[model samples]
Target chain A: MAKQERAIRTRRAILEAAGAVFDEHGYMSTTIAMVLERAEVTKGALYFHFASKEALARAVLDEQVPFGAVPPQPCKLQEIVDMTFVVGQRLLYNSLLRGSVRLAVDQETPSGIDHGAPFRQWAQALTRLLELARDRGELLPTVKPSETVELLVGSFTGIQLMSRALTDRADLADRLAVMWAHILPSIAVPGLLPGLDARADRGARVLASLEERAAS
Target chain B: MAKQERAIRTRRAILEAAGAVFDEHGYMSTTIAMVLERAEVTKGALYFHFASKEALARAVLDEQVPFGAVPPQPCKLQEIVDMTFVVGQRLLYNSLLRGSVRLAVDQETPSGIDHGAPFRQWAQALTRLLELARDRGELLPTVKPSETVELLVGSFTGIQLMSRALTDRADLADRLAVMWAHILPSIAVPGLLPGLDARADRGARVLASLEERAAS
Candidate 1:
C-alpha cells in the first residue's frame, strides 16, 4: 500500500510537471526532458510512469475533466452553471486544464492520439446535465439538449481562447458569465430564467466553497 | 500602366500562394521557398513584396478584414448577421482568410506582430454595427454594443472552430445560423425578432448577390 501511494505521488508530480511545460511551450515543442527536469525524477522513474511524450500529453488531456466536489443543487441548471464557474476557476490556476486545452487546440499535435476525447467528454457531461434539466422542466420545450451541449462547449472554448489571448484568461469567469447570460435566456423556461445565477463572482465563490469543504 | 498592372498581379499571386502554403503548413512550418515555388515568382520578387515570412503573415492577416460590397439594409442587426454569413461563405473558399485565422491563433508566431489585430478589428466592426442597431432601435435596451460585440465575435469564432474540426467547416453556415438564433432573442427587440432572417442558406445567397452586383 505504501509503495502504491509513493508510486501515485510520483506519477502526479510527473503529470503536474508535464502540464506546466506543455502549457508554456505547447504540445509540439514540449520535450520529456523538460518535464523530467521540472519533475526532478530520475529518467528510469519517468519512463516507469510514461513511455513517451505523447503518453504524457494524453495523461494531461485526461486530467482536464475534473470531478468537482460541489454538492448538487435542486436546479440542475444551477449545477451546470456552477460546473462552468468551478472549471473556469480551475482553468485560471490549473496548469493541467490549461495544457490540455492548448494541446487539444494545437493542430501540430500528432494525429494518432485522440485529442478530441476531452471535448467529447465535456459535451457528454453537459448533455447529461441538460437531460436532467429537461426532466425537471428547467429547459424550454424548444431547446435541444444535444445542440445546447455543442453550443455551450464551443462557445466556452471560444470565450476561453479569446480570454487567453486578450488577458491570459484573467477574465475567463466574467466572459463566461456574459456567454451564459446571452444563452440561458433563450433556452431556459421563462419562469426559471430569473433565478439562474450567471455571475462572474460565482466562480470565486464556488472555488472558495470547494476549498472550504475540502478543508472541513 | 502595364508595368504597374503586372506588379499588382505579381503581388496578388505571391499573396495567394503564401496563403495556401500557410493554410496547409501553418505559419511556423511554412517557408518562403514554398511560397516562391507555388507563386512561380523569383525569390527577389517575393522578397521585394514581402520582406519576411512574418511580413507575409501580416499581409494575410490584413487581407482578412474585407470591405463587403453588400449594400445597407434597413436593419443594422440584419447587416451584422449578413456580414457573418458573407464571411463564412468567403471562408469556405478563401485561403487568405483561412491562413490569416490560423496564423492569428498560432502561438509560435513571433510576438512582435499584433496577432490580436484581426480579432480586435472584428470586434470593432461588430461594435460599430451594434451601435447602428441601437440607433435604429433594433437592439434591446439592455444590450450593450461593446459587450455584444465581444460575445458575437467570440461565439462566431467558436462555432466556426467546432464546424471546422467536426465537419471541415461544411456546416459552418448552419452552425452560425444556430448561433444567431440563440443570441438574437436576448439582444434583439421583441418586435424586430420576427423579421430577422437567420437562415443557413443566407450566406450563399448573399455571396451570389454580391457577385451579380459586381458583374453588373
Candidate 2:
C-alpha cells in the first residue's frame, strides 16, 4: 500500500510537470529534457512509464484532462450539455490547452487522428449527450443529432480559439452558454426550450437557496 | 495610363507571391527575402510598394478581401445575408485567405495594439453586414447583432482551421452554406426567413438560366 501510494504521487508529479511544460511551450517546443527537469525525475523514470513524447502526450490527454470519466448524475441531456459547458469553461477559460491545440494545427497529421486525442474524446462526450437529447425528443425531428453535436462542439472550440488568440478573455464560458441557449431553442423540439428556461430559473433558485443557507 | 497599369500589375504580383510564401511556410517562417524571391521582384521595388511586411499584409486584407464593401445589388436583408454567406464561401473556399487567417492567429507583434488586428477587421466586416440586415428588419428584434456576427465569423474560422488541419479538404464552404440554411431561420424574423429561402430558390433559377444561356 505504501509503495502504491508513492507510485501515485510520482505519477501525479510527472503529470503536473508535463502540464506546465505543455501549457508554456507547445508540444513541438517541449523537450524530454525539460519535462525531466520540471518533474525532478530521471530520464529513465520517464521512459519507464512512457515510451515516447507522443505517448506521454497521449497519457496527458487521457489522464490529466479532467474529462476522463463521466460522473454519475441524473443523466439528462441538458445536464450533460451544461456539464460540458462548465468543463469547456474551465479548460479554455485561459491558456491551458492553447499550446497543445496550436501545435496540433501546425503539425502535418493524418486526417481524423490526434496524437494527443483530447478533441476526439470531446466529440464523443458531445455525441453521447446529443444521443440522449434525441432519445428524450429534446432535439427537433428534422435535425441530425450528429451534425448538431459537431456544430455545438465546433462552435465552442472556435469561440475558445478566438478568445484565446485575441483577448485572452475567460468570458468564453458565458458567451458559450448564451450561444447554447439560443442554439438549443433553434434545435430543440417545439416546446422544449420553454422547459430549458424553467431549468435555468430553477438553477438560479438553487443558487439563491444555497446562499440563504450559508447566510443562516 | 501605362505607368498606372504597371503599378497595378506589380502590386498584384507581390500580393499573389506573398500569399504563396505565407501558405507554403507559415507566416513566422517566411521573411521579406523569401517574399521577394517568390515574387521575383527587386528589394527596391518591393519596399517602394509596401513600406513593411505588416503594411503589405494590411494591404492584402484591404484588397484581397473586400468583405466590408457594399454588395453589388440592393435587395432585402435576407438577400444581403445570403450575399455575406457567398462571400465567406468564396474567401475560404479555395484556401485563398487561409494563410492570412492562420497568420492572423499566429503572429504576435511586439506592438500589442496591432495584435488580433486582422481578426478585428473580419469581425467588423460581419458587424457591418449584420447592421445592414437589422436596418432592413430581416433579423429578429431580440437578436444581438454583434454577438451573432462574432458567432458566425468565429464558427467559420474554426471550420477552416479544422478542414485545413485535418482533411486538407476545402469543401467546408458547402458545409457552411448548409449550416447557414438551418441557422439563419432561427435568428431571422418570422417573415424574413422565407425571403431568404425564396432568394436561394431564385439563386438556383438564376444559375439554371445561366447554364441554359451557355448551352444556347
Docking class of 2: acceptable
lDDT tens digits, residue span B1-216, model 2 = 699898888887887778667666655456999889988988998998999887766655454345323334454455445544554444544333555665554423223325366667777766776788778777787778778877776676665555454445354544455456556766788765654542323333434454687799
Error of 2 at A152 (Å): 1.1
Query: What lDDT tens digits, residue by residue, belong to model 2 across residues A12-101?
Result: 677667766776665656788888999998887788777877766666655423532233334355565555454554454333344445
Chain B, per-candidate TM-score: 0.95, 0.75
Best by DockQ: 1
Put down candidate 1 lDDT per residue, B1-216, tens digits, no spaces.
699899999999999998888888877778999999999999999998999988998888777767333567899989988998888888888887887777776665566777778888889877988899899888889898998888887787777777776677898888888888889999999999889888998888987877898899
lDDT of each: 0.83, 0.60
Q: How well does candidate 1 score on lDDT at residue A128?
A: 90
- Which residue pairs show collisions in model 1? none
